[model samples]
Target chain A: MELAIGIILGCCALGAGICMGIGAIGPGIGEGNAVSKACEAIGRQPESKSAVTSTMIMGCAISETTGIYSLVVAILLIFVAPGLMVNILKEAINLL
Target chain B: MNRNKRLFKLVDILYISMIILPIMIAMVIKILTTPLSQGISISGARIFFSIPFPVQDLIITEAQLNSAFVLISILGVCLFLTHGINSGNLTTRHHIAEWIVEKVQGLVDGNMGEFFKGYAPFVTAILGLSGFSSLLSLCGLFPPTSDINIVAGWAILVFILITYYKLKGGFLNYLKGFTEPIFVMAPLNVLGEIATPVSMAFRHYGNVLSGMVIAVLISSALQGLSSMVLSWLPGFLGEIPFLQIGIPAVLSVYFDVFSGCMQAYIFAMLTMLNISGAFPQEEYEMRKKKKLLKIKNK
Candidate 1:
């Protein structure tokens, strides 16, 4: 029982760490690419700066939603799931 | 002139007292409640009270209270700004109100076209509520935006609006839209439609919650570090978490102010875009033509 609880807690922490670490990379790269392109577009058409900037921000924010989803999952795993899994495991052990 | 100056000085004193009194009262309460030996602990919003109901008890939380306060303050500001109006003589408050209205109108017009100008007030309300809710964290209160339920409610409202606009085309057409290209894609389309509100709610909630979590973590870390570093000093002075002073302010500026404002703007922009995009172009054109015909006939 002790071992099971320990494993559950340890795995949850690892999973949360991996979740955020891996999940952030895509959004980081995507946002960087977006901002760079926006800069290039602004350079090309100096007159449409406001329009390009707003569009860029909107697009970046939308793309960042995926990262936010991962963050939410990671937080859930870290804060909520371990205790829940441990409780379930304990109940199963008791039933057995 | 002397009498007028004295009255102005008295007003200044009153204004200063109004600001300081709250802080003084709060400090007194804190000192009375909290023991000196205990370090500051970060936690979720406290449940103030709960009401018993038939099915389940309704619990009122700090988020609800703070949000209510924010709403009331916003209402008060709006009332103050629009208290008196005149065509010839305008106050600075009038200018500020007009500027806010113009900006919201411009944003709606730019994003959703001139036809959707009527949604400016709706967009402004969302922007104000979300932005102010998040900014409430700066006052050391639990921001309502950090609560998933609050953001989810807003997202659901936007989702309903989106569906309503889409249904304006036709119920059959709205269903048919789900099977575009191939019937096999219908499930995916349905899932995508459902994901819209989920994503919006999660995105806003996660961002604000993460900021809050980080702020709390950093503050507690600073408290520990400060005590360790200042251990060599004398009694009360050593206990003081000096490192917690200026650093959190800088973090709060970015996390509370910038992130809060950006998320609010993005949420408002997405609301406008989704609602506008959901409206079928053909239907819009037909309505436009009908309106034009009516005007011409009149």
Candidate 2:
């Protein structure tokens, strides 16, 4: 039972790590591309720096939502999951 | 003059660093005033007159004040800039501010006018309701927004607006709006008009309250796990002033500056779209032409 619990936790840990990794990719690339595009636009039109800055802020907000979701999942995995607690409680009851 | 220039640059940096500006203010406030430091750890749910609506919480925690003060201060600056310090006269700063305002105004002019106008009544009502959400949260009262009832109210509002507009648009014209030679969709267009606002409200409330829940759960879970783990690591040090006042600051930044602002803007946007789509202006023009046609048919 302990070994099964360990495996379940190990899987959750791996799943969370994978989630963070996959989730970061899309936002990272999208944000980087957005910055580069903004920089290029600003370079071409220095006067429009305000326009570029606002666009960058807006795009970054849209891209960052997925990263927030990943963090939520990671938090759920590490702190809130009850699988291990349930198993241990069952063990104590059986012993009793 | 250069000394004046250097002073301006410093102030500019202070203002631009949005997270720290508030932290510095909060720290000064913390030092000057003794904080109650005591949170009632309210259930975030309460009954009033046998109705299970979440009683608005008047939570006066440092976290809540930090958020509210920073938020209100920023609102003043953004909406009424001259109301505060003239800001650092950092050489080009005035121009930059004016330019920023212009661009944002341009964007608003491009999209928001038609959006806001047609949906004025609904938008006004939601704003009045949710503005109260902020007030209730500030005063240690349970916020109704946390309850499903408040959200259901918004959902019903959207449904009614959509139906009212569609029905008033007349059966044929409204059906035509749904099914035009109009693109690659007929039923999808009809479905989308409905799905948009309701989904928007749910996504927003779900996201906002979910953040609060996560923050609460984090502290609770840590209380449970603190015994097992390296107690040093959850390093709420971010919440501490020394190690990184800025780190914990980012959470509120996300919660308020990002989520709260986005949710407000989206609520306004959805309200506009839902209400406006119902009474599309073209319908009036169409009515005029139909009247002329009827006379000719006569």
Candidate 3:
């Protein structure tokens, strides 16, 4: 029982860490690419600076949604999944 | 002149006291109620009370209370800005109000075109409420936006508006829009449509909640570190979380201020974009033309 509980907790922690660490890379790269392109656009045509900037910000925010979704999942895994699994394991052990 | 000056001073004092007294009372109550043994703990919005019903009991949370306060304060600010408006001899408040209205109108016009000019107030209200609600965390209150239900409600409203505009073409047309280009894409389109509100709600809630979680973690870490490092100091001095003094403020500046305002702006922008994009432009133009012809005939 103790080993099972420990395994559940360790797996949850590992999963959450992996989830956030891997999840952040895509948005980071995507936002960097967007900002760089926006910078290039502004440099080429300074007249449309405000328009490009707002569009870039909006695009970046929308792209970040995927990263935020991963974060929510990771948070749930860390804070909620462990206790829930432990409780279920305990109940199963008692029934056995 | 002396009497008038004294009266003005009295009025100022009264105004200041009206603002400060409630805050002071609340602070005292909080200080008294918080247990000393806990040291510091971070959690979800505290439930103040619950009302019994036939089904589930309705619970009032700190988020609802803070959001209500934010709304009332926004109302007060609007009233103050719009008070005694006129064409001539405009006050600074009047100018501020005009500037805000113009900016919101320009944003709606630029993004959604002139057809959505009337939605400036709705956009402004969302921006104000979301921004203000998130910023309430700066004052050590539970930010309502950190609550999923609040943001979900807002996102669902925006989704409803989008759907309403889409249905304006015709319910049959709206249903047919799902199977555009190919029949197999219907499920994908429907999934995408449902994902809109879910993504919006989760995006805003997760950002704010993540910032708050980081803040709490950092503060608690600082507390632990301070006690560990400063354990050799005198009584109570060592117990004080000296390391927590200015670091959390810097984090709050980004998380509470910048992120809060940015999320609010993004939410409002997405709402405008989604709603306006759902509208059929050719139909709108046709309606406008028909109206013009009817007026000419009359």
Candidate 4:
């Protein structure tokens, strides 16, 4: 049972790492593309740089959400929830 | 937790005092200091609250309390339900569903169409939190939002709402969200999907609470600096002691207005995406990309 919990946790770690790795990829590319475009627009119209930069940041921020989610879950797995699960399982096993 | 329980009780009392003390202080200060400051009154502003700061005493501006109200109301709705706080007139947590169900009290409350399907939780949360804050304010409590916990509570609420929405698809859909095109990576995707909200909540909560802390510190520092410098002002620049207001004022704008609003918006956006991400196209892309990568590696 200790091994089982160990394996479960190991899997959780691997799962969390993968979520962050893959989740980050598309958003990273999406934001890079957004910034590049915004720069082009700004270069074309220097006076409109404020507007362009604002939109670019907004778009990039939106694009960044998935990465943020991946992070949140990873932290939760590492720090918070597993403790609760472990406690619950222990109580259940003792009851049994 | 024992310490936390005591701290929370202390805060609860302070929350009650916050609603009363500032107005009382301003009134007393006014009655006593009037005729001297030429009738200058803090009570001129209809709404005032304090975000207890490192400084001697930092009273949040009218705009700050209004912003705090908007923010805390959204967050308080969640704590009202989950944190075992006694909210409303309820004596106990037995009516857990009652708090959630009042969400549907919409359309009936002259707020027609305020009850929608997907946005239901978000709207209900906002309304409930705001209503709770309003109740506290009406009862002359400082609304607890001026306290950082209220802001953190809002962040947690968003996180929970997102997680709950996403989970409706069952763990299978959640699992598939990360790597479902093939059997190998399906498990990885599952883990990634789950971690999203935890990050979003912390980032947002940190941003908003820290931003409030910054604004208070800046204003207080500036207040102290201006008064001290005025006495030392070269007689030539005597007219310009308060001219340095722009420095702290600008910092106040960026920290309190821009960053604060952006953090709140990010919290909401992530909340919307949590459940919405369950749609299958994202998985299909992940799977397709995974297969393509495998072939290229081969």
Best by TM-score: 3
User: Candidate 4's residue-wise lDDT over B1-298, tens digit each?
Assistant: 6997798677655555554455455345335533654421122223345657786577654334444554544444344344444443554443765655564443223222222244655545544443443233232223333344454556566556555644555567755555657778866765655456445545554344344445555656666677677766677564454835567566656655565446544444445445354434455457668889999999
Model 2 spans > 4 angstroms off: A1-36, A49-96, B1-128, B131-149, B166-169, B177-191, B217-250, B273-280, B292-298
lDDT of model 4 at position B24: 53
Error of 3 at B75 (Å): 0.8
> Taking the tens digit of each residue's C-alpha lDDT, what string does model 1 give over B1-298?
6996687567556545544454344345435545578755555555767999999999987667667766766665666566455545687978999999999998898889866779988999999999988987776667889988889999999999999989877778889999999999999999999999999999899889989988988999998999999999997989998999999999999999999999999999889989999999797577668889999999
The clash tally of candidate 4 reads 10
Error of 1 at B68 (Å): 1.4
Model 2 over residues B23-81: C-alpha lDDT tens digits? 45655655555437743242434322232346864434444444445454454344333
TM-score of 1: 0.86
After superposing candidate 1 on the true structure, give the runs of residues whose Cα lies further than 4 Å from its correct spot: B1-42, B284-298
| Best candidate (score: lDDT) | 3
**After superposition, candidate 4 runs with Cα above 4 Å error:** A1-36, A42-55, A60-96, B1-191, B216-246, B279-298
Could you give the interface RMSD of each candidate, to one decimal?
0.8, 4.5, 0.6, 5.0
Tens digit of per-residue lDDT, candidate 3, span B1-298 = 6996687567656545544454444445446656678656656777778999889999987677667767766776776667557536687978999999999998899889877879999999999999988987887767899988889999999999999999877678789999999999999999999999999999999999999999999999998999999999999888988999999999999999999999999999989999999998887577678889999999
Docking class of 2: incorrect
Query: Could you give me the TM-score of model 4 versus the true structure?
Result: 0.39
- Angstrom error of the Cα, residue B10, model 1: value is 16
Q: How do the predictions measure up, each by TM-score? A: 0.86, 0.49, 0.89, 0.39
Per-residue CA lDDT of model 4 for A9-77, tens digit only, reads: 787788777877887898899999999999898889999998687567767776776665666576566
Candidate maximizing DockQ: 3
lDDT, candidate 2, residue B134?
35
Predicted structure 2: clash tally: 11
